[model samples]
Target chain A: MILKSAEAKPHIVVIGAGAIGSFYGAILKRAGCAVSVVLRSDYETVKASGFRFTSPLGDLSWTPDHVYQPGETPLQTPDYVLLCVKVLPGVDRAELVRSWLGNHTALVLIENGLDIERELADAFPDNPLLSCLAFIAVSRTGPGTVNHQAYGQLVMGNFPKGFDQHCEQLANLFREGGIDVNGTDAVVGERWRKCVWNTSFNPLSVLANGADTLTMLDAPGGEALIRLMMKEVIAVAEADGYPMPPDIIEKNISGTRAMGAYKNSMALDYLNDRPIELEAIVGNIVAIADRLDVPVPHLRTVLVTLRIRQGVDSAHSE
Target chain B: MILKSAEAKPHIVVIGAGAIGSFYGAILKRAGCAVSVVLRSDYETVKASGFRFTSPLGDLSWTPDHVYQPGETPLQTPDYVLLCVKVLPGVDRAELVRSWLGNHTALVLIENGLDIERELADAFPDNPLLSCLAFIAVSRTGPGTVNHQAYGQLVMGNFPKGFDQHCEQLANLFREGGIDVNGTDAVVGERWRKCVWNTSFNPLSVLANGADTLTMLDAPGGEALIRLMMKEVIAVAEADGYPMPPDIIEKNISGTRAMGAYKNSMALDYLNDRPIELEAIVGNIVAIADRLDVPVPHLRTVLVTLRIRQGVDSAHSE
Candidate 1:
């Protein structure tokens, strides 16, 4: 399943030109792959200015070779589609993917949380879908500009199945673009591992108002509490039959402390008064816990607190 | 015990001329009580402008009989001293109370949290130390003015033993001054119960940035998280032999929601960027949990998050 040099570049379509999608598309374009970005009304700004990426590796700016709008532009049915939109409520996001998905098209999900892929899989059982865990601190600082605060490799693989040649070929395409891509057979485990970190830290940072480092270090009983919450997450993950390694939890905790001044995306949303990804993050965790019949008191507590903060009642009628 | 009205009213010294002290002093003055104020140098404006209370009960403005600094005042122990200063870290606040505590003196501890009374009880074992829970949402709108948001009653009682005559007498005095007073024998329970409310709502409000009602209602899973945290607090309280009723927790939640646009004290502290009362509220809860060998996973998580937020470590070092 390992891809070598000189393979035919796949035509990749990145949905939603956010930080993650822009990062991926711009890099793929530099790797000699034909990249198409589907954008909104702001497409002209991005096309004219291109995407400015400031990373530790170096800085680069590039405009995608092709652009498309959902209804206006007729899509060519890309060889691969990267779903990069933030999870907005009531949006039939799966249908949007279906528009660009073809028989040979492989869908890679780069969004936060674990359940989106499962939902997509259920909706399109025959579609070849891969789940990816991104470990980078990326944000859109301005129009057509993304600031890469931190850099880590992307861990991705085919879900529920072993890695195939297509997955490796895509991984190779990412690697050629200077992305540290790890093609794992245990994509679910990796996603759950990432979830452990997200569920424990993201809302906490948001609730504490961009004080992730303090939450990790100085909060009264903070370290102990995070450990307990993560322990619950690990338990839930194990009960769900995709047990993440103990070291994964430890690594996340340590990595969070090491992150020091990095504010989580949830905190950013709260600051900007944007609707949070509460359903995908906290709500999904509770749903999974209910499904697995595991007691997740701490996670449930955080979830409820976040839900109330977001003004959604128990009925979630909003 | 109820106090029989006497021809000569007893002299009261309000130590700490902050918002609460000023409100009480102004009310007592209007009620024909002889009151003096001990305040910091920064509170000179209160002396110049007298004191004003704009409350739902009624608005009043009056200058106290005298305003004295700590060292400038003649040292004559009064019948009662209302200790109203914030709990500054490392300061032996209880010892500061000792200077004003005479054999017959009654001291009311009004700061947020529980253990301060315990510390005072250890110091002044003989004197009548009344622990009070103030429910009025009084904020110092100006130097000598307080804007009372709501008119909730104050609960007060003596320590260790059941309510004595002195507790009732103070309750009567407050009642005479148009303050709703609930004199109870279960002062300890009252304090712990108030702690439960403060611990749950205050930090959440501060973290969410003055949106307690919305955050508690709208934030995904916020209510559940708050309920879980309350359960943890109740468990710790029970283990410490101060079990709060579930109804009280429910009332606190409903009361907070009812407060609507009002901001909690923690939110005020955060807005002012002042040092938070983390130790008094969240810290004491964690400490008591450890002491009683009860698990408070949710409280611990939030406490840690807030601690990092306040830069408590650096504050401690300073």
Candidate 2:
């Protein structure tokens, strides 16, 4: 029951218009798809000015056809839903996605790490889910601007069926929108590979209270520790039946080294004295390793140190 | 034999008159000691304006009788030399001390750690070596002004000998000059005890990349890592036949907690992107543990991480 090329454009609803969400939404809008974004009230400036995308390929700007808050508008489920929120523990995402989920909705998650897909599936079992691994260094500069620091393609795949025509249709839509989308059966492996990079590099950046460049390039024992953490991650992934290849891990490490002077989000949060998304980034890795009977000694040590640094056990006095 | 109280004051030389050195030199001058300081040319502002001490106890100013650079002055050994340089690797401290080491010279190292005493002893075994544990929160405000942040006290003793009469005389001089100088038989032990506090807290502060209060009070597991690092240090000290009591360690931790919003020197260095004294603080502890056959897993991890952080292998690039 796939729609043909002569039919009207598919309606896409992009929730949480942060940097990545905005980037994809702008691209889709430029390609003649009807795109709408649900954003916070604070992002009114973005709605007014439209989004400006500066990339190595070229610069472009796009204004969404519609912008609405979660509860303010009479909602209609779109043909496609893209969830782009900062994933943290205790997030009420299931309830947030309830009104947006319809019989025909296809959802794609563009957040960091894995397990969120499982969490979503557990909550909304009947809905379709697709996982995406974004390699671009996109960050929001202002209300309606995303600074793409580096250029890379997106690898996506079907969640429940492993890979099918639905995944191809979605990839075709992204391709029409000028996004380099690779739809593959190995999407789960791709997501886990990205997880290995995040788990090893992100927490170390936070704990060292330094930039990514410092952690990857300068810190002693940093590279060795990163390799060890990645090795443990790969071991756990293999035990769980979704291991990353050695070459991919090496490429990820090398990519980070090449991006000199860029501070990871975790390090930025630490410098600003904000609570980190530790559980999602590193704690989950430790928990998974334990479940799979894999020894992640280096990650565990770093986890304990980060917890101590954050004062995890002490009751808040104020 | 101790020199009797006479009409003329004994000559005292203070090396590295930045803050702590200037504070002591100013006080010594006030107490009728002929104080001369060897300082860098950049500290000409302090030399021009004299030295100002701002403390809760009282405020005072003193103009030193003489000031000279490392090689500018004619060679002459003083009765006492107070070494106050910040510890760094390959600093050639032995050679620096040699220029001022006369037969009767009593060299007292009032620096941050205990290893300097061993370094001095190894360099000039015959000269009387005095080890001092200085507890003060003082910093240079300008060329000649030092801000006494909070507390100040000195625990001093002679190595390889019980309280020498000269030690008692120096203690009397410091006491008369309004300094809390405690002469103990186990000054080396006291020095290591202070190090246990620093080795645990200083690096944690640097790694946490926040004020002492945040790590000590606000963060979870903050105090636990402090305790764990201290435990490793204590084990190493005991293996070297100088066992530190749990109570002393507890007091140091509690004292740090009480002094909220304080930033350690290492944290300041990291913030300013200056080189840190990693070897003097954490590396020396690791070196000692290795030599003594003590397994210091926690310390080893921290040491390696710090070495990576500073790009110790690629120091020239920094």
Best by TM-score: 1
Query: Where does model 1 sit among the CAPRI classes?
Result: acceptable
* lDDT of each residue in A25-137, candidate 1, tens digit only: 87777677778888875588877777888987677567776777775443466788999887767767787787788877888888887676777888788878888877777
lDDT of the structure predicted as candidate 1: 0.74
Task: State the DockQ of every prediction.
Answer: 0.37, 0.22
**TM, every model:** 0.87, 0.80
Q: What is the TM-score of chain A in candidate 2?
A: 0.88
Quote the lDDT for A28 in model 1.
Answer: 79
Superposed on all Cα atoms, model 2 deviates from the true structure by an RMSD in Å of 5.1
Error at A249, model 2, angstroms: 6.0
lDDT of 2: 0.73
Cα lDDT computed for each candidate against the true fold: 0.74, 0.73
Model 2, span B23-122: residue lDDT tens: 8776677677878888884358656877887887587577776777786542456888888887887688887767766888888788776465677888
Segments in model 1 whose C-alpha atoms lie over 4 Å from true places: A1-8, A54-60, A147-152, A212-215, A254-261, A264-276, A312-318, B1-7, B88-91, B149-152, B218-220, B243-265, B268-276, B312-318
